[model samples]
Target: MNKSRIFRTLLGIAIVSAVPTLAHAQKANWQNLDLKSDSTFGISTEKAYKELLKGKKSVKVIVAVNDGGVEATHEDLKRIMWVNTKEKPGNGKDDDKNGYIDDINGWNFIGGPKESVNFETLELTRLVRRDQARFANTTDANVAEKDKKDFEAFKAERAELEQKLAEAKENLAGITGFKTALDAVVQKIGKENPTAEDFKNFKPSTAIEGRIQGILIQQLEKGSFKDFYEDQIKEGLDYYTRQAEYNLNLDYDPRSIVGDDPNNDKERFYGNNDVAGPDAMHGTHVAGIIAADRTNKIGILGVADNVAIMGVRCTPNGDERDKDVANAIRYAVDNGAKVINMSFGKAYSWNKAVVNEAMKYAASKDVLIVQAAGNENKNIDVENNFPNHKDLDEKTIASWITVGASGPKDDETLKASFSNYGKNQVDVFAPGVQIYSTVPGSKYKSLDGTSMASPVVAGLAGLIRSYYPKLTAAQVKEIIVKSVTKVNHNVEYAKGEGPDAEKVSVPFSDLCISGGIVNAYNALKLAATYSGKSVAK
Candidate 1:
């Protein structure tokens, strides 16, 4: 569920549109605009900066982006990257003696002494590979009492993998058949890219041809045949193919490259200094959303202006390891990061104990942790999501914010179509749909998911911390939570997908704890007045 939603495309817009709606779906820097002023459901970031934080003296705050990897050298991002003044650049030694060598920006646990891991099997697949040795040959009655839970879990994982593989293959077959049919019709049309007019002018000789023409004509009304084929069909092929080839592949193992003991949660300090790993796109976009250079005059302005981005590369194309995530959190806190942004999550965990220890460590340091509520569209209160603030002892972190995605409108689409929500679990909602930000290679692109939503809250957290340096991490969370723009209307919540998708009119209060979307203008106003618990910076 984690990696499957990470690289989701905007092809859904192009596929259903009458002409191409891809360009229309994107609104540049809409997340930072004022909702009332701009008629978009944004964070009102610009209003806060102009009214509350414009001339205020502030201190620099480091916000760690704990995700795939970040493009630190991006045109707008390079100047604001957290530089390790204690370490000498490109040297072989740990100048600061922090265990990590030459960590100019941050650390990458995904990397080892030689190279980094790009593709990894899902946690279910990893569990299968590990537990299959002991439980594969055993039956329900043959297992010992102590090993019963593990044996049952192994069985469940194996069954899930089988089902996933079957579904992937079935979806792949459907897409392939559709592509074959589409190609045949395109060949008959004799046009590289057909339009609605072309489809209407050419008469269908057969029933299948007529059906194909009808479908293609609806698509061409908003997009071209090329757009429909590439966005809808090819994207599906890639997704299902990846599920079969890498994510669900039990034989594939990429952990040996890291050369660390997966069972040893006590083991730390075993990764390389290459924060920008093989895939920096996700993390780079996350960093930009949090604090892209505000005055760069090169690209879009980030939510926060004066802040340092600490790139802690932990997440990859797949579910992040708990050991790596724990280490990443400790490293960021130890390296002077006051706020950490986690944009990736999964439904399973390999080792929650280590991750719990790291969360406690971060909490002790008064660092606010902000994480996405995931893109699964399932309520976390009923479903499972890993790396949550709750520890092994069931004690939740005091300075944690769980964010859900909201769109650019205050209507039914206000809550993003794919956002996960819970009245008790999720803290607030933020702009996450088609958010434009810095990508790898000094480029930029718009991406969707709660991954984008977490950074928006993280940016606002950084902004508050920078301006109100005396506020504790808990107080910062309090201000952000108590100062939201309340929504008082009923949203037509779709319970399922497609024709069977029932649109239930539910009050926005049932979505998340805050019962509203995040507003920087309101949060800053509350932060200025909030002084219950104070800390010296």
Candidate 2:
């Protein structure tokens, strides 16, 4: 990454702690923070303390996380998780009549309340099957041409997946071998609970120690892979096992377990209320971000307080099918999830109509969908991404908002290098870069993506709704748009190996629709003035 760009982006900022100084206590108002201070360039979370987040109640709202399962029992996320009292745990009956049998908190659409796949591209498999069937036939001109194009696409995808699978397998093997050897060494050496670092520091008389040292050293250098351990290694094995079972083999009839045809539009009522799945980390983390209890000091503070996190596990490690997302939306809407946080997307969509109809369904229910503007650094205006409802039609959909990532520093580098952007495609920018929030396993970690940004905004919207409750979804959208901190400061652009690259600085306003970072404090404060009597608060 561009260290200088990052440094400049953060410019001058300090961490916000529990005890506030007099100067810290008296934070600049939002208007002043935007014009004079460079803190906005730096995400200004500390500045957010004084400027935006100080006086607000932890708004109670449930934001659905539709991604990989979260570590449900993480240290920081346990207290505030949503629970469904009506449904009995591990019951075979559909107690709620919501179609899902015993969904306690949320439902896993991929696993079907039973067996599911992992990290597999169902779309690629579909395309692959179609191509293979056509390749065998002496087809007509149009059929042959289409088949050729499809074959090329499939070939590329197959190559990528094969490489990824190979890598996963290799890594899995290495981890397994290392763990076995380490286990033997630890037994002989009379040690236990040795971290990778501990193993590295200790000198052993065996070749296994040297190999372990090499792996540990390599891991330490990467920084991002530091969390690896024997247990994590075993988890990796499970991941690969599922990958082999569901994704690679393409045995995607998981719906039979739930006793519903996933492909059939009318057969939507089958899943049970087993929200936690065998594992429920992803949805839990996403839920915690929206409504984990604040100031509990147990795990982490969520953006909103009063939400009932409705877990809808539609995403696996790979591409989520159109049907899953569509049905997930309908489920959340039907079950009273007012704000849906979709931190997932895919490159290829076989049935746009299914997703589009789901989007409309959510809209008609007066639910707002906060979708992540994908993580590719490229501009999305040129390329069409699946699950995007508004950009395709000339007519606009007001219920959906596409969020882009912004770093803590409020400058050009503020825009996350990985976040996809388009002047018209993305709705606004928010603090998605280096965001500290809840993760799986009852833990908290700082993740960076437009995925993080979407929920922050969703949480803010929930806050508005919690206090005002009567604010229409459209009105909430307007309130957020009108309440942004518009900045026109000159700053650097994307820093990487490319033409038109360098410190080619420009006005920050050119970057996004509002040209300003999201500030919950300002939005709520402004909305609070008009919130009287009109809203439910």
Error of 2 at 266 (Å): 2.7
Output the lDDT of residue 190, model 2: 60
Instruction: For each candidate in turn, give its C-alpha RMSD to the true structure in angstroms.
Output: 3.3, 8.3
Q: Which ten residues in a row have the lowest lDDT in candidate 2?
A: 1-10
TM-score for each predicted model, relative to the true structure: 0.92, 0.72
> Candidate 2, 38: how far from true, in Å?
11
> lDDT tens digits, residues 320-438, model 1?
88888999999999999999999878888888888887887888898999999988778888888987654433223567889999988888768877788888889999998878889
Which lDDT tens digits does candidate 2 get at residues 6-85?
11100011111111121322222111133236544322323444655567664455566666565445555555555667
The most accurate candidate by lDDT is 1
Once fitted onto the true fold, the runs of candidate 2 whose alpha carbons sit more than 4 angstroms away are 1-60, 70-79, 83-92, 113-119, 138-259, 390-396, 489-510, 529-537
CA lDDT of each prediction against the hidden true structure: 0.83, 0.61
